[model samples]
Target: MTESAEVECVVVGAGAVGLAVARALARAGREVVVLERAGAIGTGISARNSEVIHGGIYYPGGSLKARLCVEGRRMLYTYLDRHGLPHRRCGKLIVANDAAQEAELTRLAERGRANGVEGLTFLTSAEARALEPALRCTSALSSPETGILDAHGFMLSLQGEIEDAGGAIALGSPLIRAEASGRGFALHVGGAAPMRLNARVLVNSAGLSAPAVAARTEGLAPEHVPQAHYAKGNYFSLTGAAPFSRLIYPIPEAAGLGVHLTLDLGGQARFGPDVEWIDPLSTDEIDYAVDARRGDGFYAAIRSYWPALPDGALQPAYAGVRPKLGGPAAASDFVISGPEAHGLAGLVNLFGIESPGLTASLAIADEVAARLSEAA
Candidate 1:
């Protein structure tokens, strides 16, 4: 016999995005319950990331990524400050290795400005070198708003807020299946203790498993379920002291942001996330191991901007897989589908929420809440 319960809202996956969504709904006076497949919160995509607070520079103007990232960055900074959480607006520099790449930097600066990103400055080679003498570039773009934070701390803060608002998170509980029941959703959850939840609202923010979760929904059409692609990113940590104080990035790549260097709150620098697409049957089948040989490619990429990078300086740090909607050559934007998209009154599915997902979490939550409220 399965235990049964009822809730006003159910948020699948207790990642940063899911927790933020739950927090928003809970604060809105809804009885929300978050379900996590893993034994812990944020053990999936949220655990493995650059943890960099993006400056909304790479995305196209008028896109959700641009608007939410810019909006969320401001909100995040304020939230962190108020909560006394650890973070730093240490800033970042997007370096153009040669004259050819300088053109790309100019385009990016324009896009950033159009997206309402603040404090974007173009720097000549001399001006850039003056700030970071170790960097080698023909030109660079300074995004003073770019920063890093304690991602885990932020997620925990969200969890605390949800609890404070009388919401709960059920770890180790996965949404086995979902069916549209009248205007609400009938959710069958599986875990150490299997149970059923009749939720007035359902949000599929399952990260990598988002497509899989949607596939299991009875009323959702197959056309609405996009193919899930896993792009594994491997990081290599610096063996010695970091030469630069700020985050250093080469121009963006098609699959990812390239082998950019990001600093942790402790000021330790790590470079990574070189795109390696894998065909995994499920998220459980994917391996998170960082292949040491991949570090071979990191040398040339890092050397382009920091020629002083020494041999054997990089060690296998970790690996993270982005839940991508497209392949290696194609790019995709964040898809937050609601009732308007699929005619599902109380369901919202999030797809391809990579990169700035962490930075845009709170804003994403706000959007999800508004969509559900309108449907209600």
Candidate 2:
């Protein structure tokens, strides 16, 4: 027989989004318990990626990605300021490599406007070169609100808020199974000390594993769970001093935002995240290795926008896999499934939370809280 405990809410996964959700509920006076399979928090999808604070561009108008990113970016800056977290509004430039690509820049600016992003400025190649002397482009769109932050520090702050409000984050604890209980959920937990938890709510913010978790849960209708796909991106760190003062991006690609230059808080420049679709039945089959041979492709892509890129300057740094709902041919939007969508009361599932996920975390948390409240 499994030991049992009770809580107002049980959140699976301790990624950035999970922590944000936990903090939001705890602040609302709910007794929340966050379960993480890893020994430490943020070891999964949250730990990887570009860590760019998006400026509400690059998403369809009125979509959750656009709305939540715009709202979340503002909330994140405010939260970081109030807490003195490590972040910088260093800005970003979306460049079109040649005159043939100039129309895409115009469309991006128009899209940004539709998405309510502020301060989007169009620039000629010469004008863009003025901002970042080494930048090469036919035209560029400057997004002053786009930036970078210390992702780890941000997660720590969310964890701090959750704990301060009496919420517990149980690392090394995984949700083995979950089923709908009377007006809530019954969760079977796995860890050093296995037990069952009865809670008023269940939130699956498991990031990459969310789809799998939802498929296993007893009450969730299988048809409600979306198919899972992975798009792995590889990053290569620049070997020398940074070439540009701000983040630099080429025109977007079908599978991702494209191979771009992102600067860390310490000002080190790394270019990469070229899209490579991964096909694996289990998460264990996914490999995060940054293949050096892939650097040949990076050199070519990076040189297209920055001709000054020297040969052999690209070094394999890292790789991150984006949890996607669809494949390269068909992109998917952020899926936030509440009781309204699945008819499962007190349960919310988040899927395809990649890219702007770090930027949209707070707003996502707010949306999750609102959904749960409506069910209440």
lDDT of 2 by residue, 183-289 (tens): 68889999999999999899999999999899988978899889999999999999899999999999998989889999999999998798898888788688999
Model 1 lDDT per residue over 85-174, tens place = 999999999999776789899999999999999999999899999999999999999999999999999999999999999999999999
Pairs in steric clash, model 1: none
What's the residue-level lDDT of 135 in candidate 2? Answer: 84
- Model 1 vs. true fold: TM: 0.99
Which residue runs of candidate 2 sit more than 4 Å off their true CA positions?
Answer: none
Cα distance off (Å), candidate 2, residue 58: 0.5
Cα RMSDs, all models: 0.7, 0.9
Each model's C-alpha lDDT?
A: 0.93, 0.91
TM-score for each model: 0.99, 0.98
